[model samples]
Target chain A: MTGSAAAALQVEGLWKSFGPLDVLQGIDLEVAEHEVIALIGASGSGKSTLLRCINLLETIDEGRIFIEGEEITAKGVNVDRIRRRVGIVFQSFNLFPHMRVIDNVTLGPRKVLKRPASDAEADAMRLLERFGLAEKAGQLPDRLSGGQQQRVAIVRALAMQPDLLLLDEVTSALDPELVAEVLNVIRELAAGGMTMLIATHEMGFARDIANRVCFLDAGRILEQGPPAQIFAEPREARTRQFLTRIIEAGRL
Target chain B: MTAQGGPDATSRGGPASLPGSRAQRRRDERTSALRSTLVAFLSTFVVFGVLVYIVVNSPGWPAVQASFFAPDIFWSSLPGIVAAFLVNIQLFLISEVLILALALVLAVARSSTAPVLFPVRLMATVYVDIFRALPGVLVIYILGFGIPGLNLPGVPTDPFLYAIVALTLIYSAYVSEVYRAGIASIHPSQTAAARSLGLSQPQALRYVVLPQAIRRVVPPLLNDFIGLQKDTVLVSYIGVVEIFRQSQIVEAGTFNFTPYLATALVFLVVTIPLARFTDWLVARQARRGGGASGAASQVASALGRSRGGQAAP
Candidate 1:
């Protein structure tokens, strides 16, 4: 395949499996620089696994993933280095439960990047302040609300200034009232031209922020296009059924 | 809760309990109180108090008192017992530090997944299983006497050093299990998050996992340490004159046993504080995790008052 300057991430014939289960099958995607790509799927359609494969968190059974023209799946690709560049935030907001919020955000910078404590903390504080969480700097993750914790997870990833961000259903675990706080953070990141691949169940947020949407079904991309087309004029019947359920549930 | 323990509906203390009828509540409380009193009386006074009375009032009482509880002998022997106790304390302190360091290393190695650490993990696991099954006193006897008996070139035969080494090896096996439990108890997501941020496996364990694991296991680790403290008397069997040894020597020479009783009292004096400290730590952790707010709220209120006291100039 030709290298495209506009593409920040490119996946070629990606496949993943877990023993007897085929989770991601023949997934090919190209995310242009500064683009927000939202993956919309039913519960077991391999959306999250696809994002994980891109970050090399879940190893692929076959195929390759390229980040900014460099193949991350090749042998001796330095997985930790690739993981540093493509940071991921889980739905559970897996913050280091023992550390204070500022410490959690600064840990990566200080340990991996070998930044001085003072410099790392300054960077962490800047990210926290941007997310309106400056007062919680000294508090542990359990002390914060679900939404606040999710936002802190984002700040932790952003502290590294990664080339790409993989957000896995980041707001799915939050209460309805708390979901906006987390979604607003993502909106601001998208507005600031952060290249993010998000797997989400929030159809409205997908429409609002995503430049493109991929609708996955049973381990394959059934339909994908600009969010306007995928949401309003889905080409596949499975996509239509998913949107209809979301609409009836008053979530669309 | 107390006032609502009445049995009849109209006879209940007040609106405090609107669910259970007063008659039922009173019956429950009465039965509970009766069972509690019966247990307290049987377990405490009848079983223990009666035995003590029989022993104290027996015809052999005077001879036993002369042998074991003669106050004059206890007072006279105190200086020697006190001197010997200092040796036990020194052994305990030295072995405690060494055991903690060795246990932490074993725990980390046991928990590692890297193929390079496979043999170390197997060795640590096998070591813990074997030594935990081996009787601690037997370990002391074999090493305590065997090392000195060997009398190898360049090897020290000091009983103090042997005692310390034997205790460390035995206790490290137990303490390492506590550390491993602590490390395993930490959720895997913590490591996932750390590694996602680019920390290597060791870096992840050091910066994120161990601090939490160590904090959680402090109470249990202290329990093991206190066991080590009590086990110091076993060193006397190896010919180091700790408190038990000094007390026994006095008993043999003077034909009185008060020094032995004094040694028992001293052991209690040391052990009780450690037991209490461990209880406090476990309770503090529970309160911090928001369990048992009855105790936790009291702490919070006390803390509030202290801060207010400071702010009042």
Candidate 2:
């Protein structure tokens, strides 16, 4: 169990780059338990890059990432172990197309955790049933709707029982009608006290559900606070400009 | 092939039904079919007829027939040629299994990005390049003569195994490229999705990449297998008495080349079944529609169509 004392995730002066492009420039943040932090920014603001650094999917150029009081970004850390604790759901809903829904959900638990097939399947069925995907357990992911596939992707991450969940534009790829279903699932997960760091463009959903909102700009968290202070009261002019553009675009 | 009263016939005949009932149509169809059959028979005869005439009229025809086409020598050579083919089959089967397993390893090694596996990657690259460049006959000569000439302890002296080693080495290099192409064809996103779930790279490959890769390459792999089966005759260059070598021995004796024809016919007999099997694999892959996603997408589209019809306003 993750203890109450430590933040679920802590990033200190994290920097990352790809060749000539500097993606993340010294990002520092700490997320408390059961916290839902909404990372709001325009396209190419390095929101996804920051989340990927936390999961160790992208090698950082500098600084360290700690999960549950232990720095996992240090050299020679067990990658699979760290990954097990930090589950990620991608924007594309990259389910193994060849596998059945139940197998997709059970794969991490069975192969990584070495759980018995019966136990894993039983647990997967419970997750699927809870997510209204029990009927799709035998079906391939290609057969599911975009919204249903995103929901299954969430269930897959939850099946690992991760200490922290990294959601990278999870609903950005869905249709307008489908976005509601995926957002509903995220809302339920938030209500269930899942610690999540979400990169999203849905300003309304972020305002409605996020415990804290952090506006990322050019690889930096320029502003962060409770949604009330951040949205209603001004902090930085840049953050205000972003909010005004979102308002003009009718996204907020 | 056209239907009765088809557009072309009806348009040209102009009120064909005026003179003919359905019974007359049937009779006309039968006559046209018989005429086409006779034309096919005569065309086949004419093609072979010219070649036979040229050959039989040649000034050296009697001597050529005595030395090359002697029917008695062909009959006598059948027993020996058939016996030697059993050896070729044995070599082909054993080497095929070894080459398939070995080539998969080489392919994976070549694809490895692990820093620690740099040496293995280099070795696999070098092996494939050298062996692929080297001729099959040269490979057999070196392994058959060279390794044994070293007189190393525990090295095989049997020509049979030496041939297997040479053939496996050469073919695995070629086959590894087929495997590499298959593996690389798989999208990187599949591996990323798998590794993101805590499966190690190798585990991801075994569970995700390989199943799809191997299935996708079954048709190509069968092609390489057939090539290997034919190349089993090259083992004779190292003094193994396989079918070709057996034919040469029979030809040297009795001063008749008909034994060569018998050997060639026997090879056709061996390869026809394998060729048919490759065709079946190709047909099955086609029917399955490309690969794994193909079948699933077909099912998905069918589901889409049925549901779309139901949901129509």
Candidate 3:
């Protein structure tokens, strides 16, 4: 058993269901500070649901989730405060279509953290510059290319100075040529020790960036180990089958 | 040009038409357009001319004309009716402000998802239902007369106040529904995105949801505004001396309905431009492919400019 006391994120026996279909069932995972964990799974394998539950974006049917050793899922916990420390980048690049890239980045800092607009904007500009998106600061999300928008979404999340980040299939929606740019941004974040929980279909990139790779199937984490072990010699049969399918599809 | 398709398709030039043929086709198209325009003009002229002929020949035409279209009475009553229209303008303007504010409150209440606010949502829903189900004039009469009859000391007995209140209440119910629909039209993903950013529910609604929702509903809100403007005439029943009431007084005194026609003219003059403006806004929104984005982009640019200004120093 992992030490939940010092973990950056700890989910214990988390269960979530939408109607009769159980999206997550008794899922337990723990990530140490500065750890980057990659969730690998098929389309309906509860990866997104697990990420959403950890972010408190989705209400869990049964579970206790802790972040930075605090019981975040406890009753009367202020979700806004919890979420302020945990940022999420959605698969759809759900950057506010109405807001410019800079505004999107600065929104959390200004509204949630109570940072002054100028300060938030200056920080956001610096982040955008780092992502090579400084020129797109004033453009709307729709005006950006898919990869640029996703990178802006990452920037937006990072601007909150979140202790933990949840990335849900961040590159799945991008065209092949556009995927590299978004992956590069993730690589930079991981290298800088941002402690991300990423659900991705990008096997090669996940193997490259993740400290540990977890295989989720049937709403549970079936296998987890160092990326080299999991990717090369997954122990569980389902994990082997999933890896075979991925390899057959030329994804790994 | 080579035409290899069908027998009937040979007459019209193909896509490979020479420059001369293309110019000829353009001239032909212009000629056809002009011909269609002339045909439409002549047909409209004929149709209206026959109707005028029948009306002019009718035995009651002279009497009807004198009663409703008397030139001298119309010209004399125009100034009075126009003056009274200022009262309508005030009533609607005041009522419009109240309606907008109240309707937004009601819409937010209805759209809220908190379990504790169930009673507030219920009350807002009931208020909308009751006001919408009741006729505008009935509400006006009930409030205008009924409130005063209650002998409520704080209540102003002025019918003008009731006119504004009644119109505000009735239109607020309708405008709230428009707002609710706008709120519903915005995808839940937007709320998720905002909430995930640590924004509280109210903040999300205020900053993200309401801005987009209100922009989406602007054209519809203007539609309700037009309805409220016309319904201001209904307040005359409660004894407000608006345009309709002034026209009625003139009609009663002169024993002719020409002043009513003058009132109609006033309405047409005022309402038509507003209606057309609404259409223009709707067209612009449609051309931009969605509500909120065009206005949102304008807002974005404005923010960019302001941010640029702030960043300069």
Candidate 4:
């Protein structure tokens, strides 16, 4: 546990573009060990793109991503090794529909980590129980509700015991009633000191649960600070406008 | 009041008995008669054409009874028919296994972004294009004779083996397209999810994408198998002793065409079940809400319904 003092993730001047469109333009951020950082942005603001780059799903055009203080941008960085240290969840649950819940959870550990099947399943079941999804272990993802499927996805990632978890609007696809269930799971994770960077639209969750809140606009980080300061005392006009629009929509 | 109502009843009955009503009824009868006459004319034309064809090309009733219905010819050709049947089953089994395995590799390779994947993409494109564009007869010939000195040792250079390999190659190309479409049809989010779980590219494909792709592609794969079953008859050209080739031999020896008709019957007997099975699979896929091709839309609709259902609860 003493090693937890190191920064869980560090990003510096990350730049990504697809042809003419610049998605993440010179973004810099760092996630401390066991800290929850909420990334708030409008559509096409590159918040999701930034999360993907952090996990190396979308290769950055130029930047350095370091995990445990080791730079991962250089050639021959063994990307798979870096990926093992980070886990991500999508807006859509993206559960493997053909696989049973437990198999979905254990696949990475069994295949990537080379753990024995028995050990993988044991760990998977423990994570499933933590997410309150133990009863649905034998069922395929299609058989579960959206909220339950998202939770299973979280458990699937957690089964890897990743050092950092990236959640990109994990509850965006769920029903209004189901959103609370998934958020509760995330809240529980945060409470247990799991380092997380969540790109979310749930203003209340972002404001209350995140240790630090970062506002993204047009592929750049516009403002970032502790949630109490960022939400209650906005520094930039753009940040103020963004928060006001979200608050108005939440009331509707 | 009852006396006043009696006049209203009389007026109502008068409308049904009027001369204008009778005229309208006659017009309706004439229209119905004309419609029936037109339908009868079309039906009679179809039935008459079929009857005339049968009468003209009957091959003589006495000859048919003697050649087909007689026990001698039917029983004598049993061995040949059984041999052909066995070869057909073997051809399908071998070709299907090879095609499925190859198609998976081809599909995945084509989907990858690596520079090495270019050759795989090119090969898949070329293979599918050549086989699909060229006739099956041409493919069978190329495999049979085009590969100079390409005989397996101790295997006698059998045409049946050549035919099986040819069919496998041609069908593998077609099946690869089905697989590509199936794999492409999956929501990209699935791969993203697997990657997010720390799976390598190959691992994600092997454990996640391929399974879903195969499930969606099964019906079409069966359809391709049915097509392969029929095309096996084309192997008769290389003297493979398939059902059609055996029928040709029997026809030449007996100087009767009954064997050719018997070959047709045999083909129908084998392929009808396969076609029906494909139909059943398609119907089952349809019942799963018009197949898995529209997976994104299906997911969205399912999410919408769940949201609505939850609201009521």
Best by the TM-score measure = 3
lDDT by residue (A55-142, candidate 4, tens digit) is 8888889888888789877788887888888989888878887667888888899889999888888888888887888888877677
Record all residue pairs in model 1 with backbone atoms less than 3 Å apart, i.e. clashing. B6-B26, B7-B22, B7-B23, B7-B26, B8-B22, B8-B23, B67-B257
Give the range of the ten consecutive residues with the poorest summed lDDT in model 3 chain B. Answer: B304-313
- Which number leads on lDDT? 3
Task: Residues B1-313, candidate 2: write the lDDT tens digits.
Answer: 2355667554445445544645457779999999999999999999999999999999999999888888888998999999999999999999999999999999999999999999999999999999999999999999999989999999878999999999999999999999999889888877877877889999999987886677677778888888998899999988899999999999888878898888888878878897897777666556865545654334334335232211011
Task: Assess candidate 2 and give its lDDT.
Answer: 0.87
- Reference-based lDDT, residue B310, model 2: 13
TM-score for candidate 2, residues paired by index: 0.81
Whichever of 1 and 4 has more DockQ, that candidate is 1
Write model 2 residue lDDT over A47-113, tens digit each, in one string: 9999888888889999989998899999999898899999999998888776778888888998999
* Model 4 misplaced regions, further than 4 Å: A1-5, B1-83, B146-155, B290-313
- In model 3, the Cα lDDT at residue A95 comes to 77
Task: Per model, state how many residue pairs clash.
Answer: 7, 0, 0, 0
Model 1 lDDT per residue over A1-252, tens place: 234474799998989999999998899899988999999999999998998788777889998889988999999889889888988999999887666788889889988999988888887888889999988888767768999999999999999899999999999999999999999999999999999999999999999999999999988888889999999899899999999999999998
lDDT of 3 by residue, A1-252 (tens): 355357898889999999999999899999998899999999999999999999898998998999988999999999999998999999988778777788888888999999989899899999999999988888777778999999999998899899999999999899999999999999999989889999999999999999999999989999999999998888999999999999999998
The lDDT per prediction is 0.86, 0.87, 0.89, 0.80
Per DockQ, the best of the predicted structures is 3
User: Each predicted complex: what DockQ?
Assistant: 0.44, 0.24, 0.54, 0.24
